[model samples]
Target: MTERACILDTAPDAVGGALPAPAAPAVSSPESAAPAAPRRDMPRERLRTAGASALSDVELLAILLGFGLPGHDVFEVARTLLAQFGSLRAMLDAPPEEFEALRGIGPAKAAMLQAVTELARRALAQALDDKPLVDSPGAVEDYLRLLIGGRPHEVFVCLFLDARHRLIRLEESSRGSLTRMAVYPREIVRRALTLNAASLIVAHNHPSGAVQPSASDRRLTRVLRETLALVEVQLIDHLVIGTRDTFSFARHGWS
Candidate 1:
């Protein structure tokens, strides 16, 4: 017999001829073999196409984080951070040790977050350099909020303005315990003299989230205003920064 005929004759199934064409190699369905879908809608892609403003706060944060940990996606990590801290501002304001303690955030990620907040603070400072405070009251309020709105303790900041009412310097003149801060008008007046500031805007945060000024707040404002006027410096406004809104003395006709 020919070679092929010999092989066919030798090979057999239980009751049949050759082994039924080897059962055609058991191919799997396409769905069973398909690879995972690609991640095409990442924050970077959306940011490039639609601009940074289009992204949600979490998305912006995910981009900053760059990548995820072994078991979590970057979005999940960012969401966890926000949920833990309660908001982006709170997260950014977190101390290095506290921030690093989060699940997927190590020293590097914590440093990155802190650096971002610092950059924002510096940018606001730069924006105020030659811009008149009266012309950009909104910017002043926003900068003040970013500076001390989330602090656990009370902080008093001063923005000293030149003759044209442009920002000359920003100083955190005092910081106190969670509920109280002692602000001295003599020291403030001396600092204004040292800077040769023609005008000033004073701000302090209310950790209690109340925008209404207390009696002590009003008294301090009056004292600072009178002390500053002694040296020809104008106290343009006294702003009380609360969690939700700012109380402006100028807006209320108190300045």
Candidate 2:
């Protein structure tokens, strides 16, 4: 089989180029006939011999990254992405086609990474949406995790409940920029009244991955509680979902 062309092979010829060449120090490379290790030996073999759980995150991701530049290896590519984005969650949540712009990363590899990341996301959403009434904190965690766990955007949702606390309506309350969201308490209560809801639960994502409520969050929730109290509908809880954790205002005695 023919070996694939690497970046060096695709560069303009040093001697045949139209422009004048600059001086550079000479370098030596290894012999061309040297034996090489198969890609299937590293990540794939580790997975095969040790099972998927036994592989480090870098090794597993290296399997997904597949290969790398001529002088670099797949683990280096995986490490590059990790270093660039800070975490696998950030890498998956980054804007579409953004990661492709990284060095040594091409469309094929980028597409593979995006597809696998999205596949897991879609599966999680499907699983959550198909489930029955979610009443417990665990269910809330599962549902919110699916929605906000790995996202790069800020999204707010309101789950309406009847007198029995059964879910009646699930609506998006707001979507916002990286650090701020626009919310109107009057509008939220008005929507709750329109839905004939007896109570409501609120959730929003912290793209910065800090689920702790900001002063703004507290002020908004206080206003929401007072407004909803006047109307007789209750504000049950306000949840902030971070990348790896979540914060519940109710747990902290906010609601």
Task: Tell me the whole-model lDDT of each prediction, alpha carbons only.
Answer: 0.76, 0.69
Each candidate's number of clashing pairs is 0, 0
Q: Among these predicted structures, which one has the highest TM-score?
A: 1
Candidate 1 off by > 4 Å: 1-40
Off by over 4 Å in 2: 1-40, 48-50, 68-72, 130-136, 142-146, 149-154, 161-170, 194-198, 229-234
Candidate no. 1 TM-score: 0.79
- Which RMSD does model 1 reach against the true structure? 27.4
Could you tell me how far off, in angstroms, the CA of residue 4 lies in candidate 1 after the best superposition?
A: 99
